[model samples]
Target: MKQFNQFAARPSAMSRALRKAFVYMTLAGTPALLSTAAYAQAVANDESTSATGVGAGDAALPTVTVNAAGESGQHLQTQSANGALGSRSVLDTPFSITSVTADDLADKQILKLGDVFSNDASVSDNSGGYSAWASYITIRGLPADWQNSFRIDGKPFLGYGITLPYDHFERIDLLKGSSGFMYGFGTPGGLVNYISKKPTDTPVRSVSVGYTSGNIWSEHVDLGGRFGNDQMFGYRLNATHDQGETFNEGYLRRNSVSLALDARLTRDLTWDFQSIWQNSNSDDQTPSIYTANYTGATLPSVISGGNRTLVGPGQHLNTNFQLYQTGLTYRINPDWKANLSYSHSSARRNRNEQTIYLKNAAGDYDNYRSDYLEAHTYDQWQAMVEGNARTGFLEHQLVFGASWQKQVNDYTVNSIYQLSGTGNIYAQNTNAYYSNTALRTYHAGEITQQALFASDTLKFSERWSVLAGLRYNQFEQNAFGIGGNRTSTYSKNATTPTVALMFKPEPNTTVYTSYVESLEQGGTPSLGQDNYGQQLKPLTSKQYEVGAKTSQQGWSATAALFRIERAAEYTLGNALVQDGQSIYQGLELGGAYRPAPQWQLGASLMLLDATYKKGSTFTGNRVAGAPKNMATAQIAYLVPQVAGLKLMADAKYTGNTMLRAANDIELSSYTLFNLGASYTTRLGKYDTTFRAAVNNLLDKRYWQYQYENYIKPGDPRTFSVSAKLDF
Candidate 1:
């Protein structure tokens, strides 16, 4: 039987199976799309609602209409895409999840992914702020890997040193815990999926202008519509330009464009195409410190406001990013469908960075500079089929799919990295630049992955159900030296599985317990380490969770108790190694309530205990950068007398974090507050909205740190204002 299994798993056999599955789905469709019914014609635009459960809609899957209170800031009441399992209402999913819509982001004036979940207690911003090298976050006390944790429309994307264009997406979804069975190989921390905006059924035109601190200004334009005699063609276009000085005394200029187009080839078939382009240039970045240098000593004094960039006089960075995707969807029948898609993503970066090494508590430091040109590209192809069926007394919703992805990394062979000058964080430097001569680019690394997945949700009764999923993955990683010699190679195959049992005690209320396993890429040594560039073996993780959810007309709430265990990596004797296990156990609570029509309230809290279970050097130590407690509260009020005015206040608190595995130093906990107001009214023939906000209202001065040795100053108080018009 074992020999038969190996023979059946060959490429040709798998190809035949895939073809048979596709044919089966095509034959089983209802053939109702050919009918001239109103429902059939409107099906193309009725995909699922945004994560906020209202307004914008997801373009990748079928959607349902969800009514929402105007600008109430209520989220988590709708369905969201769950990888191979298709889309399901949040209340029915066994895992922890959160969805934020474009409306909420625009209302809050958020442009950075690091701040996307500022109000969520289970998440923490690890990139330090907009000035950090890249944007990243920690979910449930585990750091998310950039290469595997981010997806755009269900396709993998490489985000090493770049930030995605937030304006191009209609909604963002976060799935917490191990999701290997759902999304192939990934970090055990969680997953972040971006749902791109699609053409709207109704004509939409909008323009906006905004201003931020330091004389920075921005302009954006959005247009969408459907055309043709049969209204079979739809298009959506967005363009943005930003130029201004940063609050940290730096200058930035950026431009981005996105276009989405769809065509109905037949009554039941649709084709979608999307493309995005972005370019950015920035100068005088905030200086970051190597906190590991001060391991057992008192930390340096916090640098506040624009004074934090003492050695950033000549630092600069330039980046270009592009993405293209095309897909075909066949809505066979109301209960069955099939999809095929391909996507390509690329990012190129050129930067001159300066790093500081702390010398004492008096703010003295040594500075170093480096120049580099690096590029990364990712390509993916996916195919899937989904349908519902009933056998005897049991009903099933099934999903099956296959996907392949390849990512390549390239870097300049002669990139420069060395000490340029010495300086103190308390004083400014006039020249901290280093010039590098361009050289030939070399292949640095490559990663390829293939996966086959299947899932089924079986209903035993109206109040009880079970969900089971499995995924088989084949992964390979290759690293090459400047001479084109293969330095290291790692390849492996594994199967991840997930199982959940759910019960509905009352309408709109669900309780569930789930278990899942994950496989993740191993760690590589950092630049200054003894065994730099060495790659470790693959890691595995497991998660157990129990959660409950409920939603009503005026309020919604979610609670989860979870425990996760995963392989841990740390430096020992100046060499990085993988040993022991990092265990995380936590409780999470989130809810939004409306006591009166004029008042809206929301809050969330998380308590976590993360530690290394057993290791020679770091046994029983708290995981670096993991905080024990986090909380957030927000309130918004709509004026009764004033026609269209709203006032809002939000607060976020982060607990003290460990700086290293030794637990010798700690970064103090901090709280931030924000206030904002918006007014909407009609002027002449156009609808207008004016907004103003103050972030970090108290000008709190503090230091933010992540992992073993990254530290930077938190953002200072800033003011912003914007006016938007819809005509």
Candidate 2:
């Protein structure tokens, strides 16, 4: 049998049975799915009530209350923090924020968080295109922690260290800058919030099948509806499966399921629940290449596009994640509300990896093998009370909240060994032999955090507003060494604040200035470093920003100038040190415009100057992994003659970036282009949509810079096509 066929048939009997059960369930639910479409059509065509109701003919119709839960038209605006801020406009917020809507995800064929930020000038990922396990992103020259910077519906999500499928999200919101006052202890870079698809009041049912380069195939189903006598109960479910080889010489398999429920228990109280499960595995995974070990040897030449250093075929990685969340909202009065929520998440991973360490200038290297089993669990709870009031000529929106989070991690390095073989990067050889010697001990740790926060937004006049917020946090961490012996305990307390002022000369324009601070946990030394396993003190950062936003007709524009300063840490000789400071100052410009009814344009530019202000030996050098400049622009046009037909083109550029604190090694800049086309039509009564896209149009070869001389290569040219059907 062919390799693909063999892979498809490799599942055990139990796995096959489970798959069959899922298929049977979907088939049995066909009636409900069909009814959903019928109900939606009926609601769209029902206008009799508008003409024959109690307020008929000459009388006015009752006011309708509409909730903006997700992005609608174009991806220009959002209300992601509405629950906490009382549904304020994005333009009115004193921070840089952007929303990627469902339409954008569909049009771009986004599958992961990295894909969502491919066109964002302010965002970059460290893993590049080599790793499919988890993504690490940076914003505004600061790194965001993979486990702490992700949120679901404005609440922290602990399942971020695993694959986050895009199929289950309605929209994603990005808040740039320090979020300490909002989310307590976290990275200063930014925060990413995923809004789940709510139960649809109008009913929804859709299925899509797709194929991408490297024989990857995917299938997804989404269903949502409102039921019950008064339609007070609603549900939304999503399922997806993907399998096959990736762009590289590796195999991937993934499955995910998500369900959400909404219930209106009383006239003034509502409850929501959500659950998600996901499993993913990759074989022959690509490993990150590090060049720091090549002390006196010349660096290897850049590998050609679409190629990578070969490793043992047995290397693999697997991850499983599960999450559950529940929340309740109670309206005390017309202007007062209370909210409470809780979430729990668990994740596990098994990895067997091999790294090639260069030994000479001729590409000779040693193969190092490592195996690990790890698990993580997180629990979080939050409660808040908010109200809107007016006194004399001043209007105020106030919020008071408290949150607590706990995280536990356990891991064991099963084995670490050196293989006896010398390999060349320019040649293919994977027959290296290795023997495992000693077994590593298991380690465990726990982190707990409690925080109290409050914010007030005062509208002093029709064209002026001021917002201020503060957060006080207490954090504690405990570590256990081999044999469950208590190793170390650390605790700290911090206070952070945010303040902003806004002025509007016109109804459609806003100018703002803001100051914010963030607090991050300390770093621990790696296994091979001197003082290994030692923890340093936490770090704090401050940011100052001034910006303006404006919207007129179908066009929107924003500009910002910002500066951030923070304490830094790095290895000096053999010991890790924190006696360094860094600063990043930059200007950002972005805009979206629909000049004509059928044409749309989006563009962004970022210019940064990142340097070490004070360091032992690398003072005044460029900060590692920070590019000097980045820009992206896209245009989409719809053919008026052929309805539902749209064509898009986009280009991205990244300037050179330093790979080390010394600024001796740098990754050259590169530019890439992408093209896409999508069409929507009706086949009889079934609505259908077709999409096709080509990434890296010119097959440009480039490298993504990382700290410590580690480099990741960009993906080569790839093609994808998908079709969706709506019942």
Candidate 3:
């Protein structure tokens, strides 16, 4: 037997105790997770921009907006989906996509990405306590993995974990249904496209400082200006800093930098260059080992048995996400434009995890190598030439685009054994295990994606409008990983047909119904030839939604009911289990009403029913972590006569959900409330605002989502106050 301490005899008592701790941690975490800060904001200026200066104190407030269409379409004139896309409305293309505009974000006080996604019932955060720092966002109960991609200002911002800073985003766009036709490689449920804040031709500068509970502090500065002698060039810059402690002893600090530049090449040609630098320190997971209640009865909030300690022992974690992207759009004629863009990112993560103390009750004395660190780089470039023509014969739109993307990742780690109780002198130099070489070696993959799509809008009569479209895509990826280098190329072809009929009973009300088809490549016979290679087949889905949107008297409300079905859903298992299948059916409602010029009320609510067919382990049972209902509502009032006085209160609710395979183990429903008020004034050119707010007002004790083996309660009631100043 190997002796840990050469000078002393091996103590039997210490050995037994350490063994117990290891089993406890591995068995499943108990109810000992840290707190989830109630929630975790914007750039760009047009006449539409509203800057909420930052402030410092103990108040929690989010710079928020709650719009359905999102920031991209806010400046556009058309309200309906087809008109916004011009003549690009095709049979298989998606026209029902939704965006949360920056203007709407300005009024709503939502901070965290969870707050933004709350609008779609299909979207849910399953952070579960284990990795409270990172929420496993599931859409229609589908995991966000290779199929889902995230971009900042249309540029890829991939990282090892899902921790993000919402303050830097202008708005979030949630495209419903399969989008492989346009978005390439994502889940059938949808994709989240984040638009960055762009520079404005108009000049404006402001700064805000604020704080939250647990002594959290943050500051933000936004600047915009016109460039050049002619002022054709414009620039926008935004910067933010945040520091705070979470549920336990862990801390969170994040800062991000974003800049946008625009240049008018000519009367019709425009070029924009965007860049972002973001760095954050976050925990990947902090879950407790829990034993489910066998009887299905209510269990205690605190676990009677399990490990209780701070996460990561005494290690520090740091991650950096940086990106550079430039896009060029040229108008060839009055009705046509050419779009070209390319982006690249250098994403690196460093983590340290282990036992830190002997007397401390927060950690295990294990020397196991659990800490993970890696670097991933992806370069993607795309170009598309599109045109819109309106003639006597017909009004049509055409688009031709081709894209190439490459990704490479390198993983490194060290494994060693150490003493259980002693805090120091555990392990020394030993063989290091580099994950990059052991598992998926550092490899590069090249993917070529090409597509051509066209559509036409036929206005046979004033009372009736019909639109149609078709698109084709060719995709290929050549991959090389740690197992060795392998090239897998395959060809896939798909055609999508769409039909839409809209009847405008009145000038302000429009009701429309449509169905669209989306296709995805599933297998590559070239790669699957070997055990490590995968011969992918195609996966597809169908989306059907009927919605009615009406804008009248400064109020807009839209509601849609949709049913989406996919042939198969990958389950949790060794081989990416594809046996199980499911259908996600849900309803989405969003609206904003200006009861008075100063008072605005907007709400987004979605109720869904996700059912999975018979499969290996999940046959007939509700999928784990799938919540049945989710909702959000916000009301904000700005005193028109009072310059910059605002009061806002928001409420959100997530219904009960199952936690494990038995369906007997589950987490009850919970509701949270948020309230805040802001008073703003101008001092010369400097703008300042004082704000106050409360999070988890009710202090309800509930379980956010947890596995059958463990239980962790939600956060308690907390209060905060803050102030922001801008110049």
TM-score on alpha carbons, each prediction: 0.89, 0.88, 0.74
Query: Which prediction has the highest TM-score against the true structure?
Result: 1
Candidate models: Cα lDDT each: 0.77, 0.73, 0.53
Give per-residue CA lDDT, model 2, range 355-442, as digits (tens).
Answer: 6666556777766665656677889999999999888988999999988999887766554444635577767757443333343436
List candidate 1 segments past 4 Å from native.
1-74, 132-134, 437-439, 573-575
**Per-residue alpha-carbon lDDT of model 3 for 1-727, expressed as tens digits?**
0121231243245333433432343221111111111210111121123333332221222333322222112121232222113322222223445566653443333444455554445566544321323534666555444323466654555633545555556766666665554555555666667777777656767655554554445666778888776788888888877655544434566788888888987788889988888887744224333333233345434321112242323344577878889888888877777778888887776654433222212222232333455577768777766676656855555555566666554544232223323221122212222222232224444445555555555554444566565556566656555565575555566665555666656656667776767765452221111332353455676777787766566666667787877655432322333455567777877776666666777676778777666566666676656678887777776644333456677787787777654465667777777776655543324444455666566666566653323344454455554444455
Q: Per TM-score, what order, best first?
A: 1, 2, 3
Query: Per-prediction RMSD in angstroms?
Result: 14.5, 7.7, 12.5
lDDT of 1 by residue, 1-727 (tens): 2332353355254334433532343232222212223433353335333323654333423322212223344355667877787878778888988888886667677646666787789988766434534566889988777778888877777666666667668988889998788888788889998888899999989877677886566777789999997999999999877666777767777789999999999999999999889898777767677755664456777888555356455677788889899999999899999999999999888878777777678877777777878788999999999999999988999999999989898877887767777777767765557556564578988889999999999999999999999999999999999998998888999999999999999878989999999998777565556776556677999999999988878888899999999998776657778889999999999988888877788999999999998777788999887899999998887765444566778999999988777788788999999887766654334566667778888999877765566677777788876667788
Candidate 1 versus truth, CA RMSD in Å, comes to 14.5
Better of 1 and 3 by lDDT: 1
Scored by Cα lDDT, where does model 2 land?
0.73
Candidate 2 stretches greater than 4 Å from native:
1-4, 9-76, 82-87, 129-134, 158-161, 295-299, 358-362, 413-421, 431-443, 524-535, 574-576, 706-708
